[model samples]
Structures are given as C-alpha cells and as structure tokens.
Target: MGEVTEYVAGLHEPARSSIEGVFFIAREVVPDAEEGRSYGMPALRYAGKPLLAVMEAKAHIGLYPFSPAVIDAAADLLEGFDRTKGTVRFTPEHPLPEEAVRRLVSLRRDEIDAAIGRRRA
Candidate 1:
C-alpha cells in the first residue's frame, strides 16, 4: 500500500472511514493524483502541485486544499464548518459533502493546470 493508503488504514474507526470517504471522492475527481506529503501532511498531488490533504485532529477533521481562494470560492457550501484561511474543519458526524470535496479537487486541479500553462506560455 502507498503511504496515504497506509496512513488512512492505520487510523482508528470513524476517522479512517471519514478520511477514506474523502480519498474516494478525490480519486474519482483526479485519478492521476499522486500520493505525497505537503506541509508534513499526506496529501494528494495533481500536476505536481498540492491538491488536498485530509487529516483527523483531536476535535475535528481538517481538509486542506492549500488555497485560501478555493476556500472562499466554496464558502457557501462550507457554511457552519469551522475554517481558517487554509483549512476547513469538519467532523465525521457532519462529514464534508462529496460535492464539496469534488469541487475542491477540481478547482485545485484547474489552478495547477493554469499555472503550468502560464509557465509554458
């Protein structure tokens, strides 16, 4: 198993399932995303850029897309979830909707693509 899969597999109940759910949605959205570490957290990387990272905290789960702009773009869907400039915290009891996760991965993928395009231009 990969580091990410191993990481998730090593977690305890509920947390494991919760992170797994996010990983499932992420894979569907970006099948080419690679398993890697970003900011010391296991993350999904697309086009050589950080796509997203999901981690379980003592009190809540954190979804880090690494872009404050992306968070702002999905602010409506994130209502009621505790968040900061770079992280969204949710609980397994109120896990992030698949749609939100999809949007985040898609947006970040798009951003990475755009940046690469710009660099080539």
Candidate 2:
C-alpha cells in the first residue's frame, strides 16, 4: 500500500473515515495532485508544493493547507469549525463539508500557483 493509504489504514474508526473523506474531496478538486508525506503527515502535493495535509489528533482530524491566508479567506465556511493559524480541526461526528474541502484546496492551489508565477517573473 502507498504511504497515504497506510497512514489512513493505521487509524481507527471515525478518524480513518474522516481522513479518507477529506482525501476524497481533495482528489476531486485536484485530480493530478501527488500524494506523499509532508512533515511526516500524509499530504497531497500540487504544482510542486504541498497542497493539503491530513492528520488525526487526539480529539479531532486536522486539515493543513500550509497557507494561513487561505484559511483566513475561507472564514465564512469555517464558522462552526475549530481552526488555528494553519490547520482546521473537525471531529468525526462533525466532519468538514465536501464543498468546504474543495474550496480550501482550490484556494491553496491558486495561492501556490501565484507564488510560483511571481518567482519566475
């Protein structure tokens, strides 16, 4: 099995399903995103950068986009969700919506693309 699959499989119950759900949405948003580990967490890389990362914490599942600005921009959709500067925390009982996941991934992707463009300019 791949690293992501192995990581998700190692988790128990709701956590596994919750992580998988987020991964599913990310894949839908960026079909060509490459899967691997980032900072030891399962992540999807797009445009040669980490697009999203998923991890299970003691109480919630954490979604990391590695972009505080993207999280800030999605404040409306994150109303009822627990969030930190670079991570969004949601419980298995209250998983993040697919639409929210899609928006987060897309926004991060755009941000990365913009940064790449700036570097090349």
Q: Evaluated with lDDT, which candidate comes out highest?
A: 1
Per-residue C-alpha lDDT of model 1 across residues 1-121, encoded as one tens digit per residue: 7768888988998999999999889999889999998899999888888899999899999999999988988888899899999999999999998888899888877788888884322
lDDT of 1 at 111: 80
Q: Residue-wise lDDT of candidate 2 within 3-88, one digit each (tens)? A: 68888889899788889989988988888888887877778998778899999988788999999999999888998998999999
Global lDDT of each model? 0.89, 0.88
CA shift of 6, model 2, Å: 1.4
The alpha-carbon root-mean-square deviation between model 1 and the true structure, to one decimal in Å, is 2.4
In terms of lDDT, the poorest run of 10 residues in model 1 is 112-121
Could you tell me how far off, in angstroms, the CA of residue 103 lies in candidate 1 after the best superposition? Answer: 0.8
What TM-score would you give candidate 1 relative to the actual structure?
A: 0.94
What CA RMSD would you report for each candidate? 2.4, 2.7
TM-score of each: 0.94, 0.92
